[model samples]
Target: MNRTEAHFIAQDHLAREGLLLDRLDWDAWLDLYREDAVYWVPGWIDEDTLTTDVRRQVSLVWHTRRDELLDRVVRIRSRKSVTAMPLPRTTHSTSNVLVESAEPGRIVAAASFIVHEHHPRLRRNDVLFGRYEFEIVQEAGDAWRYARKKTILQNDLIPTLVDFYNI
Candidate 1:
């Protein structure tokens, strides 16, 4: 495929991922990634550039593998999770999409997203904004797998209460 074709495919993949998250399709969303994929919600803007220990560098959230992500999903789905007792309605809006580059089988994408969450029980309509930096690879035929997803939150240092179900 050409660069334009690869970019279009990557953009579509990101759009689908946003929709899946908005619908809370955990299983389908998780399946869109490779088994060794890394999901990082960095605590600092330059976390990627910094070579220091992520744990010591104030990382927000990090999942090194697909199994870890699955575990988190399972934990949130469990009945014992108090934080998730009253599920919140979430809508993810993604925009400002830019495809940085495209190789033979890989595409680099960047986009801005706002996750609006509303929970009647908590009387909250919080908006979580971030930028997504993704490395997507074409697998079998038209299948796309997320090799890496780096989410950089707008407010990284703030101590905020996040529901376990929030993604």
Candidate 2:
């Protein structure tokens, strides 16, 4: 496929993923990622730098496998996780999707996102903004999945819990 076509595919995929997260459709949202996908949110090292190594440095969230994501979802669903208990309502908005590079079976894309979150228990509202770098891969039958997702959280001084749904 051409560059334009790849961009469209990436845009659509990202849009759908955001929609699912906003709807709290965990099952469908999980489907967007590959079984071996990497989900990482690097923490800031200093005022000017972010952590570069996942293993050595601190990270906000780092799940090397999709099953780890699934485990978190299970905790949230069962209300077993205190932080995720009474899961906050969230609306994820993704924009400025750009295809940085594309090959036959893979594409690298970047987009800006804002997640509006309302905590019912605390009666508070918060916003998280970030940029996402996604390594998307075309699977069999033209389906697309995220092979790696790196989220850069701009406002790192978080007030509440941060999870996959909210960032």
Candidate 3:
């Protein structure tokens, strides 16, 4: 694919991902990831720094394997998670999308996202904004899937509790 086509494909993947999450289509969403994918949201290392070493410092959320991601979805879908059951509605807006690099079968992409969560029973509405850095690899037939996803939330403290899927 040409550079422009690569950009469009990468952006399209991101847009479809957000739509799947918003609709709570867990299985479809999970299919977007590779078996060894690592989804992480690291905590800030210091008061003044946005930098964090996820390996050395604590992380807000971390899922090391695609299995873990599926497990999380199973829990919520089966209503086993008290807080996550009856999933709240969400609208995820992704922008500033860039396909930073595209090789024969690998891509590095970045985007900014604002996710709004609303719950009718709890009377809650909250917004989370962050940057997403992704390492995506091509699967069979030139399809791309996430190998690693890092979410850097702007807030030092999360306004509300969150999980990988919600964030």
Candidate 4:
């Protein structure tokens, strides 16, 4: 497919991801990712650099396997997670989607995103803005799944708990 076509596909995929998260549909959201996908949000090391190594540096969020995400979902569903209790209502918006590269089986896309979240318990609202880089791979039967997701949060001074859903 041409770059334009690839851009549309990537944009659609990202929009669907945002919709799933907004609805708090954990199962469907999880479906967008591969089993061994890497979901990472690196912490800033300084004014200009971010932590590159997950094993040795601090990260806001990192799950090497989808099962780890599933475990977190389970906790949220079971009401066992205090941080997730009275889950925040969120709306995710993404813009400026660009297809960095598109090959036969893989596509790399990047976009800017902002998620507005309202905490039920705290009666507070917060917004998180960041840039997302996704490595999406084509699977069987026209399926596309996130092979790796790198989220770069511009505002690193998060006031509350940070999870996959919020940013």
Candidate 5:
């Protein structure tokens, strides 16, 4: 495929992923990734740099594999988890998406995202706005997976209380 075609396909995949997240279909959203996927929410913009040591730096969220993500899902579903109790409904809005790079089976994309959470008990809305940088890979038979996802929060260093399952 030509460059334009490749870019379009990559963009479409990104859009679909965004829509799936917005719907909060956890299983369906997880199915979009490979078993070895990585989800990262870096604390800083330069965190993605090749030379940066992520362990030494602060990060918002980072999961190395699908099992880790599944574990998180399980915890969120568990009634014993106090932080996760009374889960807040959330909507993820993604826009200003740009395909930074694209090959036959790989795509690098960046977009701005806003996660709005509404909790009836709190009687207030929690908004988390950030930028998402993704490394997407196409697996066997037209399946797209998230090789890496880095979410850079606009308020990464701020001191604020957050619910356990808010993200």
Candidate 6:
């Protein structure tokens, strides 16, 4: 497919992920991850160098494989994960979706995302703004799956505890 088409497909996948999460479709959402996918949210670093070393620096959440992702999904769905309870009303807003690189069977995509979370008991809504960097692989029938996803949260002082539960 053309790069433009690939870009839209990837964008659609991102949108689908949001909808799945909002609807609490854990199984279908888990399908978005590839067998060897890496899902990472890095920890804070110095302002001068906007990058943090994934190897040495601590990350908020890092799942090395799909199995790990499955475990997370199971916990969140089972009402065992502390961060998962109450199911905050969330809306994922994504923009500036750019296809950075498109190879034969893969696409490198980037986008800015804003997740608005509202808890029934909370006084105000919590917003998480970040950039999503993804490596999406083309699968059978030219379908797309997430090979890796790196989220960079802009807020150094996050409003609340950060976790992958919303994802």
**What TM-score do all the candidates reach, one by one?**
0.86, 0.96, 0.92, 0.97, 0.80, 0.91
For all candidates in order, the CA lDDT equals 0.76, 0.91, 0.84, 0.93, 0.68, 0.82
Candidate 1 has what TM-score?
Answer: 0.86
lDDT winner, 2 or 3 = 2
Query: Residue 34 of model 5: what lDDT?
Result: 76
Instruction: Report how far residue 142 has shifted in candidate 5, in Å.
Output: 1.9
lDDT tens readout by residue for model 1, 137-158: 8788878999998876775443
Worst 10 residues of 4 by lDDT: 154-163
Q: What order do you get sorting by lDDT, best first?
A: 4, 2, 3, 6, 1, 5
Off by over 4 Å in 2: none
Q: Write the per-residue lDDT of candidate 3 for residues 68-142, one digit (tens) a residue.
A: 999888888788888765677889889988988888888888999999998767889888998999988889996
Compared with the true structure, model 2 gives a TM-score of 0.96
Point to the candidate with the largest lDDT. 4
Candidate 5, residues 1-167, lDDT tens digits: the string is: 46576566666766676566556566877777778987876555454442244788766667789788777767666766565456667676777777888878888878887777776666667787777788888888888888887766775343234421333
Give the lDDT of residue 71 in candidate 1. Answer: 88
- Model 6 TM-score? 0.91
**Candidate 3 displacement at residue 85 in angstroms:** 2.9
lDDT of 3 at 24: 82
* lDDT agreement of model 3 with the native: 0.84
Candidate 4 C-alpha lDDT tens digits along 28-114: 999999999999999999999999998999998999999999999999999999877899999999999999999987899999999
What order do candidates take by TM-score, descending?
4, 2, 3, 6, 1, 5
Which candidate leads the pack in TM-score? 4
| Residue 1 in candidate 2, Cα distance off native in Å | 1.9
Among all windows of ten consecutive residues in candidate 5, which has the lowest summed lDDT?
A: 158-167
Candidate 4 achieves a global lDDT of: 0.93
The digit string of per-residue lDDT tens for model 2 on 38-143 reads 9999999998799999889999999999999999999988888987768888888889999999999999999999999999989999999989999999898878
